[model samples]
Target: MKRQIIDTIEQYETIIIHRHVRPDPDAYGSQMGLKALLEKNYPKKRIMAAGTHDVLLSYLAEPDCVAEEDYNGALVIVTDTANTDRIDGPYFDRGAFLLKIDHHPNEDPYGDERWVNTDASSCSEMIYTLFEEGQASSGWEMSAEAARFLFAGIVGDTGRFMFQSATEKTFEVASSLIKQNFDRTQLFADMYEVDRKILHLQGYIYQNFTIDENGAAYIKLTQEILKQFNVTVAETSDLVGSLGNVKGICAWIIFVEEDDQIRVRLRSKGPVINTLAMQYKGGGHPLASGASVYSWKEADEVIGKLQELCRNY
Candidate 1:
């Protein structure tokens, strides 16, 4: 499949890469990492990263200003996004061909050609593996800039190699990426450094979070709580994993109330949670996933269902 993707790359003169909405390190890392890799190999081809740039990701990379016309006869490759609905840009299908490269479950496969590997630690790691394939088979070269992007993605998705999803290959890829010229120290600092206000909010979460007897835990971050802490909804992403440190925790949900919908971020130490995410119109990795709920009652349904999962596990 990697070889086939390489051959497809050779056929296109313009390629646009995309990722999921509300970007994460893995999303930006894989999308922009692949962009950097392709641009280095095919200098003549117009390789672009398309999406709304998140200010938080300024440390990593910025997306290109791709106009609607740019998708004409372009090869659109979406990385790290499992479903078409989650893709950031509206022009994904406007391109001539579509390709999907992701590490999530292939539940909503939307691309003409897909290379989904659920075992991959992150889509960024998969991008490095793709680089290896192209290097041996087609003499493809990777740059230090691309290495940093992939490395950041790997670190982010694997929770700095702390999660069980991280395999031996993940460590090897991380090792190879760090060998390139980039400031690993600075990257870690940028990825981990949190504002004092956010920390205060984390403290509040620690104090107020609820855990049932079955070890199914949850925390609600309403707009009122966000206002009290002076933290934006985006900043809350950094705290999703904070509850994992609690002992006897089997699974947890962090519900962030948005304008029109409530964002559900699910994580697990054991028990498959992606299926639960799918029930609420979301899907992702087995251990980590996201979903959306429109009402507080629906949110309670998710929590109750999660309790069932933890109980069964």
Candidate 2:
């Protein structure tokens, strides 16, 4: 679609930026990068970047939720969000216009003007393309900050160039960002620098893992376990993928204990995990999928479904 994003930009005196909730590095990167792009190119406009914060490297560009009054005569741009329900902030309805930019396996277009590309590795890559096509000049002369945000989103979505979605274009975007001359060493260090306590907690979680009949390994973080460790809720969920890295496992699952449900994250090397997740009213990419369960019984039932799905892998 040759949708003129700049046309939408030009219509607004102010712009508010948003991303998906439970923000990841890619979501944060694309949101921050687009915010910088707007601020640099359209100096006369007001732009606010806002989102939920609970994960890595997102702190680099903290979100500032704009007041509803700021939405007047403004265009709201949501990045890296596939669904409107997941978009951060409550002021989407307050905007004069809405636009979406995302790279997800599924596209649920949320705005008046939408650009959704599943083939692209990251939304940041799509943002780079938009800037190139729109000829919107960067404020910092292709600033280091913009490059860092874009690169962070790229690396997060590509899993540091390890995911199946990584492509030649992904590298091309990376090359372009590198040309902006940001501090590469510090970027890598900042992005991957895991806290030692997190590692220790990971080790403990790994100790309680179990593999099912079809090589679908899963770990459950019980409330008691969380109490014993004195750690945060997400700390355990973040470590689930490492368990599947065990020599022979094909699929891995993590069931984290939350207030009223168990949050389930599933990953596989050879199967479309989305097939399994969709069965539970959840969905994502083929390789990585997630769903939630109301009780331990439902969790076991989901595990049974995952076992059936794992057979194809």
Each model's TM-score, in the order given?
0.69, 0.67
Q: Considering every candidate listed, which one attains the maximal TM-score? A: 1
Error of 2 at 26 (Å): 1.1
Please report how far candidate 2 places residue 2 from its true position, in Å: 6.0
Tens-place lDDT per residue, model 1, 164-226, is 989999998988988999999999988876445668999999999999998999999999998
lDDT of 2 at 169: 88
Model 2 per-residue lDDT at 37: 76
Q: Which digits, one per residue and each the tens of the lDDT, describe model 2 over residues 1-313?
A: 4337776786787889999887877888888898887788778988889766664443467888588798887888988988988998988768888888888855576678788888999999888887776564322245678888998889888889999888998998899899986888888877666445567778875677788667878778777777777656666556756776676677888887888778888898887788778877789989888888888889988877777777765
Local error of candidate 1 at residue 129 (angstroms)? 0.8
Would you list the C-alpha lDDT of every candidate in the order shown?
0.94, 0.79
TM-score of 2: 0.67
Worst 10 residues of 2 by lDDT: 133-142
